[model samples]
Target: MSTVATAFADSSIMLRRNVKHTLRNPTTMFNAVLFPIVIMLMFVKVFGGAFSVGEHYIDYATPGLLVMAVSYGLGATATAVNDDMTKGIINRFKTMDVSRGAMLTGHVVVTTVRCLVACAAIVGVAFAMGFDPEASALDWLGVLGLFVLLAVGASWLTVAMGLAAKTTESAGLATVPLIMLPFLSSAFVPADTMGAGVKQFAEYQPFTPIIETLRGLLAGHVSQGDAIAAVAWCVGFAVLGYVWALSTFKKRA
Candidate 1:
């Protein structure tokens, strides 16, 4: 096989192995898919009336949860990578004829796929709870596109953190800030409602544009400006994370 073909084959093998591990030890997988749904339900049931979005709280809220669900890849990837590094799995792979970059790519690919599944589950549960979005086919496609971008970007960043961490605990902690970003952004509320300082910070944060874009798309009102900003953020995250992850992995491996 050619170099590209061989690398693809190697990455596929690694991806299958990682997926099997995820199936056997499904705690992380369960959390990745279920945690956001529970949070969404809690918000919809308890705080739905209190929220300023009023009648459309479920419609407005589910997108944020979907974005949050997309972030599961980060924590999962970080833990998996850290475990492999500390548990001598990386060493074992190094001794073999595996493609060096293939292992990292496999983790990234699997995380993206997992995020897709989580996003789908979130949507299904949202429907059951009366969270109906009048989005067109194109709008749905745009939402899917943003999700893929987010999953891949987060996956790379977490992979970098995992490679950098000395232990699995620290690796898991690396995701705290990431998981917290949604709340600080315009996910649950409009950034304009925030005070001056906070509004500025919330508006400029990476998660804000993403949340806004997804919310707008789902509501059948695509804000071109926010969409551009969202795509830019995704691209920036993916590029920085990919470079950082590759460099960190090379040094560690």
Candidate 2:
């Protein structure tokens, strides 16, 4: 096999290992899926009345919830990477001649998959709560594509953070920004509704463009500017994460 083919094959092996680990310890999936659902319920039922977005609040909130869902389970990804590094699993893989790239690929791919599944669950619950969208099939494709891009970027970044941290506990702490950024973005309320400093931060932050793009796609009126900004941010993140992860792996592994 060519070198690229070998790397892919090794990544597949690592992917299987991670998948089995997730299955055996199902708490990760449970937390990823359940917490988003609970949050969706709270926003739609308890706090929906407080927002005035001129539409069914569920519809308005669903896109933001989906974006937030992407961030929910990522702490585990950082911790998992940190665990492998600290526990010497990477050494074992090296001794076995496993491609270092494949090891990182395995973690990132599993994380993206996990995020997508959680997003799907959130959408299902959203629909059940009268969260109707105006998206066409093409629009749905855009949403899914954008989501995959965001998840891939976020996963790579988390993997890098995992490799950088000195301990699993610190790794978990490092990922708080991933979980918290959506809240500080245009996810829960309009950016303009926030106070002065916060509003400026929210409008300018990375997640805001991404969330706005998602909201537009779901509403079938996506702004071209937001879409461009969103894609640019995701690509920038993915590149940054991949470089940071590989460099760290070389030093630490």
TM-score of each: 0.96, 0.98
**Candidate 1, 10-115: lDDT as tens digits:** 9999999988977786777877888888888888889878779644888988878988897755787898999998898888998898998898998888888888
Per-residue accuracy of model 2 over 186-235 as CA lDDT, tens digit each: 88789988998999999988999999999999999999999999999999
| Count: clashes, candidate 2 | 0
The model with the greatest lDDT is 2
Stretch of 10 with least lDDT, candidate 1: 47-56
Off by over 4 Å in 1: none
Alpha-carbon shift of residue 240 in model 1 (angstroms): 0.8
Model 2 has an lDDT value of: 0.91
Local accuracy by lDDT, each model: 0.87, 0.91
Model 2 residue 179 CA deviation in Å: 0.5
